[model samples]
Target: MSTSFTHIFNGDSTAEAYAHSGLEGQEFVWREMVVQGPSKGIPGQESFFGPRRTYFQKELGMSAESYYSLTEEEWHRMAGASRRGEWVLWYEYDVFCQFNLIALLAGIHYWDNPPDRLSLICVGEDENHRWNTLANFSPDQYPKLLDTRKGLTHDDLLYAATVWEAFIQKAPLGLLPFAQTPHPSFPYLGLAIGYYLRQFPQAHNGLNTLEDILLQEIAQSPKTQPQLIRQVLLQRNHPFGFGDLQWMWYMKKLQPLWLQEDDHLSLTNLGKKVLEGDTVYREHLAGRHFGGATALDYIWEEDREEIRPFPEK
Candidate 1:
């Protein structure tokens, strides 16, 4: 009656760190997967991932050859282990990890007869309920957290399926209603969905929510790049779980409308006009796209609080 356990970590760093801890028994098998790309949750494997692969290579300067090699290996390993062992998922509670978790769950659900003993250990806070991440925990600290893992419930699976389907839609407006609902199992999901919706251009200002926040913060006080990034992350109820690289990507996108003087980041005349609601920022926006929609495809109309798709070309 010995249980074969397979631990699936969200990233290699966490998986490698835990392996060094010597806490995981020899009986346990560890697998790591990094699925933090824009192509996640898409229905078709090749058709959807093909463009993203090229974008990661040509646009993002990532090595597509090596990236997909590792991804395919890990995906197969996890898929195989899920059929044979007690599956334990180790994930963080951020937009990145939550999306990966949903995608993984959807994959598992698609299997004809997946393992029933699925458990999850998602960490997002410390004992005091302070914001924290898996990187905050040491190897010795992980074993204790494993005890907190809970069995996956039917409701959790249903929610994951629904979210996965909505996320892959060509039009992200499919996610708006779900964002309004409370997800107890995945608490951060609602906020993540809201954050995703805000990626669309703002109807009046033509700036996404994050872009608007950046402009507003810069208008209040000119700060260095690092200072502005810190301020945005420290906001009381910030929804974005973007890392420094992602933040820099947005900064790069808005550079055309910003002015750097005395090492401080400030808005240009056009930026100020957009901030004041006197002019729309869409035309100035760099060619940024998300999922299957470009920045020009849809707009988040604040007055109606709905995503309006642009007229088809």
Candidate 2:
């Protein structure tokens, strides 16, 4: 008789790696949802997925049917697993996975009776510091991780619930207080919230942190788009698990400030000025960003050092 364990993975890549890890009699569930989209965090209360589906299709130009095909099914599987098996959550210590982790915990809180045994295996760094993601680890490394899994506590679930509520609220300012305080259950939550704050336009340059990184990197040395992206990812200490597609979207938005000569991309005079803090980019180049229940046209006010909504036209 083989032992059975329920493994809930953060994404497809990690789940695929674990599927081939020779773990026996294990039920694998991939949490395919991304909380980066517009949401109300009211998963079961009302249907929030419809607006999210529309946002991906209309704003991001993603195929709605393709992206959200199995999400409902996977979520159902995860909830069901909690009732019957020793379940483990496999996530990383970045904003992307952390957001998902909190959302999952919030969902589990609604359960009449949660899992009998719940364990978590969250990997941030390995011995060499080269592997930041579980998908990057070898099969042999997984067994050791499985052995060291920590049990999830009630305090952890409560913390997640609080954070998830803040994340989905219309006003992101609610997160400021939470980010300032440290929670023992979630050591990385504060840092992750810091990163999330940087996602708003920077007051000085009017560029988000990711955009700033991209412009600075290209300005340092002109490189192809793929090369620049890889460099950015390599140097990133707190990656938000952005894929190539999302990177491409940001690059497309910044195209006006870049001069693509041959296959290489370089910054324009305006881009350079924007980077040097001589001029703001948001006034001319401001774009839309969705936060939970709010659709915002915002600019980072340098003097105030806060994100302010664009005045209504």
Candidate 3:
């Protein structure tokens, strides 16, 4: 029935790799960044894509037509794939891919009928605890990777829907239980969601985990944007699988805290103060959005690993 097998890849690069690997499945690249922008309500609706289109246009300069053609169309195909044939989703263990995976699972959970099978090939670290890249693997290794794919259960689908619902709502803490308890089928999900929760500003330095690392790294080794992005990829590897585009957005947002001298970046006095806990970088939250909620609405308490509503200034 349908095309026997449909492989949904996390991105174009991954999809391209699978193509060269001689896989016999129809390839579909999931090109959306659901990790960013608004996703509070039902994900597939036009309302969900409105703020998403605006955000992408403002931040990445992607046009509304391009958003529909490039991103929205892919999602519709992914929906139809459930009834088409057995599908194998190829994604990684990073926060970027995890959010995408959760959203995809949520979409599938609500689909009309289950196909012959649904599976996942989520790559993570190796025995030495180093990051593994499936795309970097040799063509011969592709078959072995496919063998590692885990079939999904109805409960797993429900879990992803529940996690996604909490994610798009003002319910970051609700994700903790799922983060604490790892699902057998979704090994890397717990760790990824844990990273997501820590995105709120930490109490110690008023910087989120990623923001603190980014600033701290920049302070240690001042570099140009390109150099800084390259360094961040190496430093924040594995579960942090952020690329240049994500880094560009973050670097732009931290402009007030960093000084750009001849295209190189370093912390400003205010940035230093914020880093040392002398000042709170509340200004960083001025126009920041974390999913459906404004980032300013919550402060992260590291010791408790929870976000508390930030008192209004």
lDDT of 3 by residue, 163-239 (tens): 88888776466777888887888888888877876777888777888888788888898798888878778756546
Error of 3 at 262 (Å): 2.3
Residues 133-173, model 2: lDDT tens digits: 78668876788888868888877777777777887776777
By TM-score, how accurate is candidate 2?
0.85
Clashes of 3: 0
Off by over 4 Å in 3: 1-3
lDDT of 1 by residue, 1-313 (tens): 9676677777777787779666542222222111223454442245544665666666556687754665544565555554565778888777667766887776667667767678888887667978777778888888887888888876677678787877766677777777788776776777667667777878777888888888888999989999999888767356456666667767777886799999998889999898888987776444556654566788887777668887434
Which scores higher on TM-score, 1 or 3? 3
Alpha-carbon TM-score of each model against the true structure: 0.80, 0.85, 0.92
Top candidate on TM-score is 3
Model 3, 305: alpha-carbon shift in Å?
3.1
TM-score of 3: 0.92
Error of 2 at 126 (Å): 5.6
Error of 3 at 121 (Å): 0.5
List the lowest-lDDT window of 10 residues for candidate 1: 26-35
